[model samples]
Target: MARMLGCSSSYLHKKMKSIQISARKRFTPISDANLEEHVRRLHNQFPRSGSEMMRAYLHAEGIVVQRRRVRETLNRIDPAAAAQRWSQTVARRMYHVPFPNSLWHIDGHMRLIRWGFVTHAGIDGNTRLITYINCSTNNKALTVLSYLFGPPVGTGYPPESDRTTEGRILLWLF
Candidate 1:
């Protein structure tokens, strides 16, 4: 056969050895009983864990399992939970702003606060344009209010809505 294929017998033998070694290394599916029990227990305990997380949990517990098999087991054991998880993964909230000035997002970034700088910025929700941006030493109510009012006063129009989670600053605005 090696002579017919124009290769040395030694090379053919080496190839055959390599093929056998790879066949040994290939994953063989284990019985699902132990895996399903672990998956069910972990799923019951965590409830919100996805297949990858369940696999990680199993790996941490010294049990090896495939993600697809975990998901299949989860679907079989708890169909409603599986469907809910699928829906949550697929569902997305749509963010829509009618016009450039219809909504403005105001936020203060404190990442640089260790260096005594806070970045206050506003962006137009629809256009994603930076309407106002300022780096100040403080994020006090006065400073944040200035950021909120400065641009609109300059442009002679206020946005219909200003979205911010800073409660104190929001109180000052209203």
Candidate 2:
């Protein structure tokens, strides 16, 4: 209703509250206690009853209620059951690493679908930390090497003595 009237919901709620202030609209502490008890009793009777079903049950008893509120109450009573309700199917294959930095997962993602630069990142398997990250104009081996080593035409060289002065390319055995 507030959106339809081009105003914020909080503003509408405040206006309605101001209007009701004169009439003294009340939902007391006792009302909350009763509601908690009602929700608990209903849940105990029908352990498997979802929000919609619980709302239907209340309506049949001449009590009007919102399904969301009922659902929240049910979840609060049993967090485990609430979690179980939303659990997805198990993965066919699960991956595990014994120690940090033992394995690294490298992936490339395009900025856009057709003609966008790609961002490459290496993530440690166990620690799940980002080992290296860079964006390239194109997803090429040279671009990846530029990130790992240094730029092709740089004044200074890398400090690592083991690095070859000659053109040493990446060779994948597997």
The model with the greatest TM-score is 1
Model 2 regions lying over 4 Å from their true place: 1-93, 113-116, 149-174
List model 2 lDDT by residue over 1-174, tens digit each: 789999998888899887874334322233545666787888899887777888777677666655666777778888787787667436578777777645555556776537766887655667776667777778776676666554233323222212222113333311
What are the TM-scores, per candidate, against the unseen true structure?
0.52, 0.34
TM-score of 2: 0.34
Backbone clash count for every predicted candidate, in the order shown: 0, 0
What shift in Å separates residue 146 of candidate 1 from its native position after superposition? Answer: 1.3
RMSD of each: 14.5, 12.3
What is the Cα-based lDDT of residue 95 in candidate 1? 93
Error of 2 at 25 (Å): 40
Instruction: Quote model 1's TM-score.
Output: 0.52
lDDT of 2 at 126: 71
lDDT at position 73, candidate 1: 89
